[model samples]
Target: MSLVSALAIYFIIWWMVLFAILPIGVVTQEEAGEVTPGTESSAPGRPQLLKKALLTTLVAGVLFAGIYWLRVHSGLTLDDLPFKPPSAR
Candidate 1:
């Protein structure tokens, strides 16, 4: 893949991993018993976004490395899939 394609794939994977990690270890204001006035009790008390972002980057990097290896070194392609297009059949 070209540099632009690699970067784009990494960006998409990073966002997906970030969303998947976002809800982990969440602590709502209601659960912590410190709901601020006029704020929703369901709001996260300590989002720890920086930590999650770092973790997401690490996970995404590992996953992207695997994908890159498969694409560049595994010698596999869409044609290797077991299923075939109806038209092709």
Candidate 2:
């Protein structure tokens, strides 16, 4: 893939991994028994966003590296997908 395409793919993967990582080790206000005034009980007591962001970056980098290796070295292409458009068929 081109540089822009590679970057776009990595961006998408990063967001996906971030969402997956966001809920890990979460402690809701209700769970912690420390709901702050005016905040929902369901809200996290401590979001730990910086930690999760770092974890997400690490996980996404590994996933992207695997994907990049497959794209460059595994000889895979669009043709490897199981489906085809009607026109192509």
Candidate 3:
């Protein structure tokens, strides 16, 4: 692929990462647990939920960076079909 196409792909992924970290609207406690509002069960669950979300984001960033590095430097991925055909083997 051309340099422009490769850079565009990277830029698109960066935007996706940014959106994953931020959102448009707020989800109330009740909405998160799928229960009615003003309920006791949803109140204490937010901390745990936030913790999980942050951890997921951190892991995703690291994983994406690693994959990007591999693509930019090493010749791997679907774009590089290194496998030989059966006849060649």
- The TM-score that candidate 2 achieves is 0.87
Off by over 4 Å in 3: 1-47, 82-89
- Give the TM-score ranking, best first: 1, 2, 3
Clashing pairs in 2: none
For each candidate, C-alpha RMSD in Å? Answer: 2.0, 2.5, 7.9
Cα lDDT tens digits for candidate 1, 1-89: 99999999999999999999999999999999999999999999999999999999999999999999998999889888798557843
Best by lDDT: 1
CA lDDT scores, all candidates in order:
0.97, 0.93, 0.61
lDDT of model 3 at residue 49?
46
TM-score of candidate 3 relative to the true fold: 0.38
lDDT of 1 at 12: 100
> Against the true structure, what is each candidate's TM-score?
0.93, 0.87, 0.38
How far is 8's C-alpha from truth in model 3 (Å)? 11
Which lDDT tens digits does candidate 3 get at residues 4-83? 87567656665676566544244656667665556764344344446556655675667666777787678677857676
Q: At residue 10, what lDDT does model 1 achieve? A: 100
